[model samples]
Target: MALVRVQNFAVSLDGFGTGEGQSADAHFGHAGDRLHEWMFTTRWWQPGGSGGVDDAFVRQHDVGIGAEIMGAGKFGHPGWHEDPDWRGAWGPNPPFHTPVFVLTHHRREPIEMAGGTTFHFLDASPAEAVDVAREAAGGKDIRVGGGATTIREFLSAGLVDHLHVVVVPILLGRGVRLWDGLEGVERDFQVESTSSPSGVTHVTFTRTTA
Candidate 1:
């Protein structure tokens, strides 16, 4: 079976995965690009970018990933369902080069983009969505590209096999936290953390009990 993974997910030290006041204008809400600053500095994001530890970790986000399942928040801003023309945040050629299943209440027709990326909307639970993505993955790994709530739901459902969380030093006192209801979730996985020079900690949870 293909493994289910969450890669390059960044959160603040206070555990907020994203800040409040999310809108079409602000994707990460009040947090802005703070959570992803380390990623943006990596060579994986652009030419001549840092080729150090941060780059190494960011590079793995798409490795062996055949399909991606993302929440509506990650797909678009809030109330994006109302905008029929909203394809996604990513431009014409999305980075995802495989079938991308978007979890949303307002299901829409599959939109094939310039690249191999095709958006398929589904109103399904984490397990159901994973099952659908796994089939489309063709035996490759499936990536759970997320918003805080989406990752939490998958974590609560025990559907994730590997989790890569980048803990940024900043603290967002009140926002969408990643570890809200996930108490003692470390027990299921052999947790490991590697601190980068950029002051961000890369923590990985590889399922040990699975």
Candidate 2:
């Protein structure tokens, strides 16, 4: 079976994955691009960007990833379902080049992007969605692309085998957090941290056997 992994997820020092007041204008809200500044500086994002530890981690985002599971927040801004022509935040060619299952209450037909990315909307639980994605993955790993809440749900369900969280230096103060209600989660995984020169910490949680 392919492993379920969350890769290159960015969070604030206060454990917030995204800031409050999310709108089409402000995707990260008050936090802005501060949380993901580390990724922007990576070679994977830009041609002239640094190829350091940050870039190394960014490069692994799509490796062997056959499918993706993301929250509706990550797919678009608030009230995206009301719009009849809302394709997604990403343009014609999305970054994801595989089947991307979007967890949402609203049901809609799949949106096929220019790339291999196809958005499948579902109002299912984390474990249920993972099962669907895993089957669609065809033996390849499933990438849990999240917006905090979705990741937390998968973590709480023990469906995640590997988690890579980037701890940014900034503090969000308020927003959706990643560690909320997830006490003692470290016990199930072998945690490791590596600090980079850019002031961001790369932390990984590999699930441990009992």
Candidate 3:
């Protein structure tokens, strides 16, 4: 069974995933960069290195992700416009080699990257995007690599099967919250595991059967 998972989704102590007034320069909000300091230092994140925690928690959470789905904001672009010449922020060969489904209001043709990576823009709803992403993922899991809003969309729809959250010790008084507008949505989840390294708390939650 292919599961929909959100990995390393950072959040502040005050529950803000990103600060207000988002822009190309101020991604994740003004002080949102502080939330993801842990991931950037991980050995798995290195360009060409493999030396970090050897726990199954880290390995499963960090690597072997087959495909990714994200909102338009995660691409760090201006609106729902796509230019064939517009390469993503990561450049020619991005980190992700599998297909990436980007949720957007406007539609664009599929973009094939240097590696096996392909960016597919879809105008359909979140559920529709998941269907497309599942096929692209083959037998592997589909990951929701979000910028807050995207995660919330999938969670609200009860489509996420697993969530890995890295709760950073920071407080953004007012910003985009990870759980914002998710008050009424109902789903049962269990804390699968927790790990602490370098003062960062990584928590994994698995959706419980109803």
Residue 79 displacement in candidate 3 (angstroms): 3.0
User: What tens digits encode model 1's per-residue C-alpha lDDT throughout 46-129?
Assistant: 889899999999989889999999999899988999998998988999999999999999999999998899999999999999
Using lDDT as the measure, name the better of candidate 1 and candidate 3: 1
lDDT of candidate 1 at residue 72, scale 0 to 100: 90
> Which has the better TM-score: candidate 1, or candidate 3?
1
Candidate rank order under TM-score: 2, 1, 3
Superior by lDDT: candidate 2 or candidate 3: 2
List runs of model 2 lying over 4 Å from the truth: none
Error of 3 at 147 (Å): 1.8
Ranking by lDDT: 1, 2, 3
Off by over 4 Å in 1: none
Candidate 3 deviation (Cα RMSD):
2.9
- Shift of residue 168 alpha carbon in model 2, Å: 0.3
Let me know the TM-score candidate 3 reaches against the reference structure.
0.85
Model 1 RMSD in angstroms: 1.0
